[model samples]
Target: MKPFNTGHEELVHDVAYDFYGRRIATCSSDTTVKVFDRNDSTGEWDLSDSWKAHDASIIKVCWANPEFGKVLATCSHDSTIKVWEENIREKQNSGKRWKRVATITDHKGPIYDLAFSPSHCGLKLASISTDGQFKIHEALDPNAIGSWTNIFETNTLSSAPSRQLQSSFCLSWGKSRFSKEYVVACALEQSYIYQRQENGKYTQTGQLPAHGSIIRDISWAPSIGRGYQLIATACKDGFVRIFKIEEPVTEGGNLQVSLINQFDDHKGDVWRVSWNLTGTILSSAGDDGRVRLWKSTYNKEFQCVGIVSAEQKHDAIED
Candidate 1:
């Protein structure tokens, strides 16, 4: 594999690719975010823009749908989330520059992860924080820029108030175009599924006992009109687990969640898990510094298909 230096003074925390994979954005502990564009002719990536994005370490960056123009959302340890828009000027030398559109300061602690909804979900964004809060924001008008409304914010507690454990760490939106309200969040040792209500509020619909330790990452597979839902999660217990969510038949029914498969091949904390475009394969990485790919077999069992070890130290990789 070809390796490219990011030129960050500190460790890079996260990298995100645009919908088309034509542009790449990377955030770092250096409090900077850099964008890279892939050269169509030479097939090499070149730095397009670099700027200070936050006062503290930037944790994550996510790209919105191209239909909404070139937009990016970033979360930082400064307890803020910012949305940026790409502005193209007429002057040749000016080229393209990113401008901050909106800044959200609802979280009282460091924001761990942020994600934009699928294109079919309109312009919505979700963020999870160490303050034990989960928030959802929507663009007031999709045709208008920089106009966002704080839609919802609720405590990330699936258990009773007395049993509140640790801060919520990670969350993932279900990629089903048919269902826009499904999201899964993981805290200390449990993962809870939340579904948006008709009144624009979210309710805890289901819960999955994830791991003995903290969960680092979670990903929901894209359901292209599939009957069931699939979710993959990585945890500090050095394991990767997949769960299947089956909906009840009758109207306004509850969800049925079951563990489909799990892998303990990683010897250290598993940091991230992602599903392929078709939702057929899964990839995971962690402190072991190796990327493992798993696929389902004809017998309906999941098995490791391949492993890619980094030549040097690498933190995470996405599909």
Candidate 2:
């Protein structure tokens, strides 16, 4: 497959595939979003709609579950998250078909990343920012996309920063249907896991403990019927590490986390880490412009299975 150029005026920040992988959404420094549709008739992707999305560079874009219709959540350097929904009522202009439904102005600084919650959790979106904070917003009324409420917000670090910092803040939701409400967010060099309580609030539960450098990205693997939870992190120190968080014996108990493995094969800052649908394969992308795949053997040890060029978390703190 050849590389198809995304026609944006500035550098593209992020590219996200919709729920079914049939539609592609891209956000760019040009402060706009363009949707590409896979042309079933031609077996090629075509730019179907493009629209100005934010006041500043749009850094990340994500699609909601199909149960919510064609909805998109975008965050930007403008310090806000805007929700967009496709207007399907006999629309004539393709560009104007996607309308902004909610403008969330609850963050203090640039929002770097955002992810929608698992489908069972309803339409909740989690976001992390350079301000050292993470927030979760929910759509109260599915029909009225504009009805968004801030359900949870907390600083990633134990204390507020004394001054502004240059950090690649990011967050990932727990990707398991059977797990309790939880999210893992990272700020500078540390990452912490937060779990919701019975009283409608979230509290810090555990921490990932194997990094001396800042984290650039994070991904929580899907559990399915697995017994444990896995999280992969891309670190600025040129290593990719996976941690295992064992399920607690009781609800509201402390989660046990230990570093599973660390790979320095990238030899440069790793910027992205993701897991396959079954959580069996792990992929890491680094500053060296290479994507390496890691798969677990029958004995449960990870080995590099493949490497490709250019593909694919957060800050954590401790007491």
Candidate 3:
């Protein structure tokens, strides 16, 4: 792996690659956001731009589709989310830069995650905060140059009163064009799935008891004409859990869900889980500082197929 130096004085919280995977954006605890562009010929990454993007520590960054131009969104501990757009100059020598287009201020606490919807969904995004709020925003115009209005918000405070101290952490939008718009959010001790209604409002469709502790991350697999939906969640309980949502035959029917698999091999707090583009392989990382990959066999049983550890060997260094 080629290391690219990000001159932030604090820890980098998150990094996101553009839809084309040619550029990357990173947010840091130093309240700055930096963008890097890959050199197509040299295969090296060069710092393209850096700026102070937030008033507090920036937690997450997400890129919009290339069809929408070079746009990005960032959330921070300041309890605010901002959308930025890049102005590309035609002249090769002219400099390109990003400017703040819109700022959303509704969440009462730190925003942990932000995700842009699939290109087919138009210009929409979702964010979850530590105040137990899940919110959705939609761009007024297709080009995303207009204002973004908050279309929906759900409060999960009443769902787990016993774990009030541990608020919502992560969320992911379902990437299935075959189904209606859906988003899954993981809070303190539970996960909730919301679906858009015919009236253009979002309502909670289902709830999954995801973990005993804080649910750190949630990822909805991309469904390519799949009959069902799959969601992967990582939790402080040291386990990664997968849930399946079955499609309903009739309109307005409740979604059916089942726990398909759970793995505790992380041995510590699991932080993130992601699925392959085809939704066939799964990967996870945890406090153990190791990345593990899981795959399914013919019997539909999920097992750990590979691992990359962070441990160092003193004997090998001495030799």
In order of appearance, the predictions have TM-scores of 0.91, 0.92, 0.91
- Write out the backbone clash pairs for model 1: none
> Candidate 2: misplaced stretches above 4 Å?
89-93, 158-165, 310-319
> Candidate 3 on 86-185: residue-level lDDT in tens?
8775322223377889999988878888999888887898998876788999996967555888899988656433443545478899888888988888
Q: How do the residues 1-319 of candidate 2 rate in per-residue lDDT, one tens digit apiece?
A: 3356789999999999997889999999999899888878988888878999998999999999999889999999999999998886734336797998889998988898999988887788899888787888888777787988998888877765556654677889898878787799988888989987879788889988848788999999998778999999999999999999996898767999988789999898999999988899999988777778999888878889888753332222211
Which run of 10 residues does model 2 get worst, by summed lDDT? 310-319
Q: Cα deviation of 315 in candidate 1 (Å)?
A: 16
Global lDDT of each candidate: 0.84, 0.86, 0.84
Q: Which candidate is the best by TM-score?
A: 2
TM-score of predicted model 2? Answer: 0.92
lDDT of 1 by residue, 248-306 (tens): 77657778999989888998889899998888889999787789999889886899888
TM-score of 1: 0.91
Worst window of 10 by summed lDDT in candidate 3:
310-319
Query: What's the CA error at residue 60 for candidate 1, in Å?
Result: 0.5
Clashes of each: 0, 10, 0
